[model samples]
Target: MPKAQETVLEINLKALKHNFEYLKSKLNTNTKFLAVVKAFAYGSDACEIAKYLQKLDVDYLAVAYVNEGVALRNAGITKPILVLHPQAVNFKLLIERCLEPSLYNAKILNEFIAVAQQEKQTSYPIHIKFNTGLNRLGFCEKDIDYITSKIAETSSIKISSIFSHLAASEDLNEKEFTLKQIESFKTISKNMIESLGYKPLLHICNTSGILNYPEAHLDMVRSGIGLYGFGNSEKENKNLKPVATLKSIISQIHHIEKGETVGYNRAFKSDGFLKTATLPIGHADGIGRQYGNGNGFVTINNKKALIIGNVCMDMIMVNITNIDCKEGDEVIIFGEKPSASIFAQTVNTISYEVITGVSQRIKRKLV
Candidate 1:
């Protein structure tokens, strides 16, 4: 509706469906899929993706926080959503919306249980997160008993799933370590479930694990990046389709003589005659400052254009010297060619950050 102009993140729902089917194909018949829709569905539009996923009847959806879950609920998403890092402060809101929370530690488990008891909640679903070497969130191995005690004391909360974060499921060099993590998680989860005398969903695989270690996938798989196309391995990425494609129209083109500088700080000094095309996107739109001074490049008419100088808050200049381009020419930042993974590597990061880092300012159009 905003006119097929300026900067736009073209979202392919068909590709999303395809990726989901591909991942689903790799799992057991009874294995569930929890689509991670946090960070505005990886900065592509959570509301839209959630709606589409709900229509597809995905087993579940996951968000990083309680507020994100509430947003999806507000958007009329009724599918079960797991809040991966729910804080104690949001326990009430989480319970109010019938949203499930991941009880990672004693503090969270007890706090949520107390809230549930106060709200007269019974058999409420809650996930237990174990720290399987990620060292980020989740309860550590020593805290297992603490969680068990809390669950035994509280009859109000029901354990929904026991999950963990993998440290490096994507790296082939870390296969042994990855296996150790999987075994540790499996052993811990089994012990806890048996001790509790109840059955709960078991899941530990993220996008990478779903591809690299299907054996680690027990009952469910929480996929984020895989749903958006880019995989940890080139082989895994083959069947997947990239969901988010960034495109911008060149607003203006300028001829730069030798010695002329471009952009802020004169970071890029033009060498010989050059043509610079200005795109209507920048850091504010998720192209960080790191992608400057020829470090990151984009494609125009299938030709590579080196990003010239520092990326501004609202604009970026590309050296389109040999290309015949003019105002309104389409420029691809990351899509189809080069790929988001290539761009992420250029910034010394991963495609996950690249896609999730895209700011909300850019319009997201679902195709």
Candidate 2:
């Protein structure tokens, strides 16, 4: 509740640790915990989050692209970094920075092997991704022999782990599909293990997957949103402490008479004498245009302030007629009260989109 700038994302390290420990408590002692820090650590500052996780002895860290892994490396993160979807052109850079790439196709596998050989690298760690059910970016069941035979030809790179992604792991209704995915992954991985002659660390569980599929914890587990403080279910969310609280100060206040319009294109017309407050946040800052037209709300003075007009690139207007607030009054966009999950639901999205969508222009203060 300290005085904040126009807009800020306050990251409570204490709450982050609380959620981390809570999720870790659900795992067995031997399960390797891999923290996914991709997308700026879910838009909470990747370097800072990865540094904290490294201190906690997190076995692995993951990012979507190679540059993200490079940023963490530049920040002095030396843990096993996984580039989930690496391009061939960055293969040399990945090797130079010691960032392991997840090779899901023959092109990436062959390219990485070529680079490793050129660098005289041997036994470098690389993760294998399989398309169990998600059908995103992963090798198929038919690619088992293709992968095993190819990797066996060279000692430049070695299989560090074999992993897959669950499609509907959190949905209780998709329990049957989740089980099938797990079984398919097991079958594919068994073929891999027998062919490779060694068991690389295997994993397929995201946050929801971890909560719903304890039996398939395999050799390790990966968690992203769970670490940032969100469970897929309301019951689980109650047990987790949300880590980031988005707050802003009321920049300006005005009183408009009936028939007066607010924002661009007369998107909102005042029904009566109404009070509104302008905030220094908008679509460019991650609360996009779709949130306008009364679709979003902010909390001020413990009262709900519905967004009354179009969300501009750098500002938004919220109805504050019912609340006693001033120009500098603090407002909560998403926090302990509205909660990221609650705020996201108001806009037909999830907490991940809301939190990670927060742009880098807004300063992140790690409290």
Candidate 3:
């Protein structure tokens, strides 16, 4: 790739393919793959990513809301899209778009049944979420009878899959907890399958779960961060390639003498003669204010330039006195060498937050 002349996020589909294949290698030959393309494909272009994944023959796609699923449908994505969280108000629109909803509770289940009945639909696909341990969403174990009774009352909707979310599949210390969650899900799925007299697809593993728990791969696996080139651990990260590279160019160079201040609120006072390079990216572009005051650094001409002072809305100044660089020179915020995970670790955050927090206003150059 050429040096960036302006602030741009380079989305490498080749890298995405590599990550996809790598993750697929870990699954059984018969296991299905569900690509989670929510939050704009983790702050990349969701439509483009979904299109590419469709070509790769992904078994299913998932989004967090009805509108997100609708966006994919508008983008010509015809794959089975699972709406991880759908509201009562959008049930009609969801059905119209052929998007499956994850009915987690009695209220949601009843509401969706009403909508499906009103729509005169038959056997519309729906996923049931069980609260094994996440405690965020899904039905309780005791609710299985209620859920089955409700299902028996209606043929308008059918259970397409039963799933759950693992709270900490990445941490080895949480092995016991994760195992319990998996076992609970197995029990729930068993009873539900027996009650329904048929088997719906069973899946509960996320990216970390896919990497850490191969035994729980069940019938399908959902991967979000892994598909975006992160495995949530040092060992697995080595096998994946980052899909997004944030790049920018030096807009201006400032020569600061002793006692000269830089940026808002005079955040930095130079103690000696030095140089600073201002790049056209800041909080507005997802660099965030927490990365300022020497906390964050960018790569310039193969050198590390520490971000000085506070991050402005649209620009950040990095000390480049020791680096051999000039205006219009390429700058790397985070990619390859210093991955997004490494960049985020400087401020005690995670790669998901940093990548997904990237502002949509920034140009995304697909490669």
- Leading candidate by lDDT: 3
Could you tell me every candidate's TM-score relative to the true structure? 0.96, 0.98, 0.99
Q: Which stretches of candidate 1 lie over 4 Å from their true place?
A: 1-4
Whichever of 2 and 3 has more TM-score, that candidate is 3
- Which whole-number lDDT from 0 to 100 does residue 169 have in model 3? 97
User: What would the per-residue lDDT of candidate 1 be over residues 5-39, giving only the tens digit for each residue?
Assistant: 77999998999999989989999999999999999
lDDT winner, 1 or 2: 2
Q: Report the Cα RMSD per candidate.
A: 1.7, 0.9, 0.6
Q: How many backbone clashes does candidate 1 have?
A: 0
In angstroms, the error of model 1 at 301 is 0.8
lDDT of each residue in 163-225, candidate 2, tens digit only:
999999889999999999999999998999999999999999999988989999988999999
Best candidate, TM-score: 3
Each candidate: what lDDT? 0.89, 0.92, 0.96
Candidate 1 displacement at residue 205 in angstroms:
1.0
lDDT of 3 by residue, 39-124 (tens): 99998999999999999999999999999999999999999999999999999999999999999999999999999999999999
lDDT of 2 at 213: 92
Q: How many residue pairs clash in each candidate?
A: 0, 0, 0
Between candidates 1 and 3, which one is better according to lDDT? 3
Local lDDT at 102 for model 1: 87
The true-versus-predicted C-alpha distance at residue 176 of model 3, in Å, is 0.8
